[model samples]
Target: MDPHDRYTQNNFWQSSQAANAALTGCYAVLRYSGVYGGAATPLWEETASPNAYNYSNSDGWNSIAEGLQSSTTGGIISSRWANCYEGIGRCNYFLANVDRVISIDEATRTRMKGEAYFLRALFYFLLENYWGDVPLILDPPDPSTQSNLPRTSRQQIIEQILKDLDSATLVLPLKYGSSDLGRATKGAAMALKARVLLFEASPLFNTNNDKNKWKLAADAAKAVIDISSSAGYGLYPDYRSLFLPENENNKEVIFDVQFIYPQEGNSFDLICGQYNSNAPLLDLVLSYEMKNGLPITDPSSGYRPDSPYLNRDPRLYATIVYPGEVWVSGSNKVTVTSSWFPITGYAMQKLSVYNSATKPPVKASDIKDGQSYINYIVIRYADVLLMYAEAQNEFIGPDPSVYDAVNQIRARVGMPNVAPGLTQDSMRQVIRHERRIEFAGEGLYYNDIRRWKIAELVMNSPIYTWKHTLIETRRFNPNRDYWWPIPQTQLDLNHNLVQNPGY
Candidate 1:
């Protein structure tokens, strides 16, 4: 029996409304579990790094951190691959058919195209970051011709990603009105470009220590920094509030994945606050500098062993829930106990909505499962500043601009500026440390360590609890762990697919 009025690819793009809805479908992919779709998956990524520990292996990150992942590893390794390709497919379909809707205005059509280009580039960037060389599919899938595609060179994919980002910047607006707040913008495209260049220039990918690559990354970051004010981007005044639901789309956010409660929400608060899935490790807790911008190891740092949490960086109080700190849930003041966090003795406070200062504290019962609506920030101004500082320091010696960029971030948290006259080597150490502390629990350290070729050094060490009790030993084989293995299922489907080395 033939269907009477079903919409197919040929009939769907006949109107502007349908085309717009199709474009929205492309954005919906961002919410997928493997993507930034939910808070748990993104924040749980910290478990794969030294910043945090995962009590369970259901999420797949713990295995990766323990260097136990293989081609057959099923959780995140497989899902991330599938999700990125799904997003890429949606983007390809939208780009191929959106122009067919003649009712759309010329300017709107170009802008939508720019948004699609930006999204496609974003998906490919994720693929290249994790899988190294992924199959680059530009057009809508045609089964007969595309079923057995070979992996494209990562360098080639990155070149195309840059091209798409450049095209997006040329056509996309700097920012949008409130109605379209989460849509891709020129600033977002530029910021993503800078991140891509910085990763490409890192030691993992740039083994030769090419100064030119660092210069390129620095220049790209500077371009975004130069336009930041006009584009309405800056550091949000309060670091903790920046992740609160009410403060979403704030000035600090360059790009974020939108989530609305009761419709499409995430389990970030429940998992992080109530369940404590990703527990902050003792290694990361000790990384925060003293209030005066000195390491705890320093003789004059004023760090007392008995009062380890006091007189520390202000950001520490804003980001972590340690013993003795009161955690308010529905008017109930519960001081954290040693048994509160069984795995690491710490919980993250950055992305949860449980502020103790609210007139009526939000009830943990209210957001028990997936009722939270806080947007996951993909890129922010503070990150751009850090990127700029790191890239510039690598390109040239510790310059004044490098110092200024990093100092701005420190000053935001009321911490002292880094000392003057630091040599390039010293400045490198400072910037790397700042990144670990500044972006902790944000799911970035895993990549930072890998790109810096320090994952083996860090991950091979033993993980411990707050009391210095050994939890478990970790291993990182530099030959295999840096690039995740392509999923075993994908290889089974395609004869041309080859597994990553040592997997």
Candidate 2:
């Protein structure tokens, strides 16, 4: 097993361990620069939305935030396209060789193959979400014969993804042992299918406004919920504690970009320091409702402008560090002060482990050495519930099941549910708001806003801080900005690749 040897007939498929490592190697692509590879994972997408602002020139995110991205200029634009293909290629290669290893048991081999299929589908899903249509390479094509390819329609690619995921669902197990914790499972495949169906059924892609599309999405999500009892999936009790390392494999997480410390891993807390990379903005802070289940604009909501942080939803405190929040650093309880004068006058607190006597020491040594071991949760039960609520509402109008699903989320965070009886349209708005607040710093808002057909409406306007201070004005060309342009390097390498319309 020479390290430099290429994956071939002579090596990598001879032993059960080699087969498993090769399969694990396919997942390594998730750690590529544009995906969940680095500390600024959330910023790569968050800055592109109105959710957060990269005040400093820390990364290429600020350019994306301003909507000044060009196919050639924006590094993330190119990185995302290339990295996803890299992951897909590994998956293809693994799938090609998985059956060669006869040393592994039938069940183990099937599950390994299932993981590869799910990962390949996931890579394609990421590509389609960012760049609407992309080349669909199902196998590792020979360079001499298939060096160039053309983009496939997003719909066609989605159908392929569903096919792969369905195959995956049959082979993958419901759960794995703790040692094999982060591997893709049957629920992971089903949850991802639900997500893909929901996105495909959104306004941005579902241009025909088909009611059946919404029903399809709703049914896919419900499929995951139906097996929740046996699958052992539910929301973690404390919202704040969910992101901590000790709770990495909690019941809430359906699937995650797996990571560990003192190995090939994460640097989330360090990058989101005082000069936070994915810093929460005032607009997001204002989006949280009062403790009494009312928007700030409502007279009975008891939201005070001057004391904005008081008596708010508990999640608001969990997710953001405002003027007076207490922050712990190596046994020292330091008050959060905005000394750098962040663009939005706020700093990100989510995904960071605060140092305290009760927890492991999260001091300077821990952060400097990249020892933060928090796994970035890609999907969780909370998101599944929200997706089910949204899709079900759109399909059959406001039903009791829809209310129960949403109320489950609200109850976990100790917030009041929607007023007893509401129309379908109003409940839609409620679900939308819940997603925004619930997933504030988690990098899902960008896709949520875009899919809901409101990116132009929210992004085009000037964004303000908590005190009505204008921070940034964004540009979103509804006709063109919905999908990022395919990278120029890709177009150069393959002439068949067409540039996105606006680019």
Candidate 3:
């Protein structure tokens, strides 16, 4: 008569309807609990969030930043894969069991199916980028159904993702209305699919030179633009406003995982997590082109690299709190001076609680500390705009509409117009640079560089800079580091599971 025993399938389909609802709860856990983790998830964990302008961690020209690990285990990056897949399994369980809810109508049933498909695609997208060739569990197995979960081909996995996304898009509502603004939408599915295609076609995955892959990516992104304009999505009035508490669930966001205040335990508001390490990297802070739509590299450009953080993109100021910005933190209005970066040279105070009334009092515990309710932008209109431009430029050799899309993003930030007749290489460079600025500290740059195929060189080579010392000798370990290794534990469980190349 034990209650836990009921969760098992003793003629599950024939009797237990409520158990299926419990399954929904399982999928929801994956939907909710999995916030940022692993190297892919920015930890900015090492830097001390300074309230005043002074470099206290005086290594002089050097201070140790956090990314080094224990020689025993791979540390966090190894553990995240297990956590990601447990949630994936839960989602897969939902996918396998949802059909049992015969009481629901076809429309309701299909919507649930669509949600499942989207969740799977999302999970795989994260896995592919991080782990590369994850064991693709399309449906939940009966405990004994499969003795081993084989590693799916990364290409086959991508193909499956595209299929899921396409199905989800057709069923998901374009508008969630006021009631469900942050949930995934048809536009969200389309944009993510487009991004996936772009990644697949890019040098990151498409080992073979297939021009059709680029065409597919372009077409998918264009579909989102063709449809999303009519939906209630436009650029947020100000790029700075995009991060404010007042801007949560703005028109721009197609989907975001909403976080809440005084949020206890592991949550999306984890930058302020233990050690508060996930600070903005300096490369990200300096990459923003001046508001004139020209890069800092341009000789005529006003921005000075030595004084790089000053007078640059408005987004740079809004997203990152640098050495000398007088910013009000919470109701206390604590002035942040230069001590922000003891080692890393920047502070990410952007996603912190901005509103006075709703601000989660900075808890003393790192897990719950300084976390805010600002919804994370899973897919935003600006990203969709950029995707359209990048895809179109690659597919059609720099279409004017592509210019318009890129320019609109610039215009939103008060940047000068994108030049007409810019070449593919120039525009591609511009987009890559803009992405570093626009999505800085949002955990996109690392992937953006990787997908652009520049990371093998950029991440591999070292430059001696004013702040970082260790990076001068660091090389991107393409063999074992580009994609994280499949968790050693997962590999042990599934004999058929193959590790990625090298790792």
The most accurate candidate by TM-score is 1
TM-score result, candidate 2: 0.94
1-503 per-residue lDDT for model 2 (tens digits): 55655755577589998888888878887763436767347544676777787766444666666777778764677777777888888898888888888898998888889999999999999999988888889887466544578889988999999999999999999989988988999999999999999998888888999989899989999999998889999999999889878878999999997777667666677655534666677788888888998888899889887788889998888777687666555666756556533556676667777522234324445465355668888999999999999999999988999999999999999998778789999999999999988887788999998999998888886777645678778888887878888877888888888888888
Give each model's whole-structure lDDT.
0.88, 0.81, 0.61
Clashes of 3: 12
Residue pairs clashing in model 2 are none
Query: lDDT (0-100) at residue 221 of candidate 2?
Result: 93
The alpha-carbon RMSD values of the candidates against the true structure, listed in the order shown, are: 1.8, 2.5, 5.4
For model 2, state the Cα shift of residue 284 in Å. Answer: 0.6
Positional deviation of 84 in candidate 2, in angstroms? Answer: 0.6
Off by over 4 Å in 2: 1-8, 32-34, 57-59, 328-333, 355-366
TM-score, one value per model: 0.97, 0.94, 0.83
Better of 1 and 3 by TM-score: 1
Collision count of model 2: 0
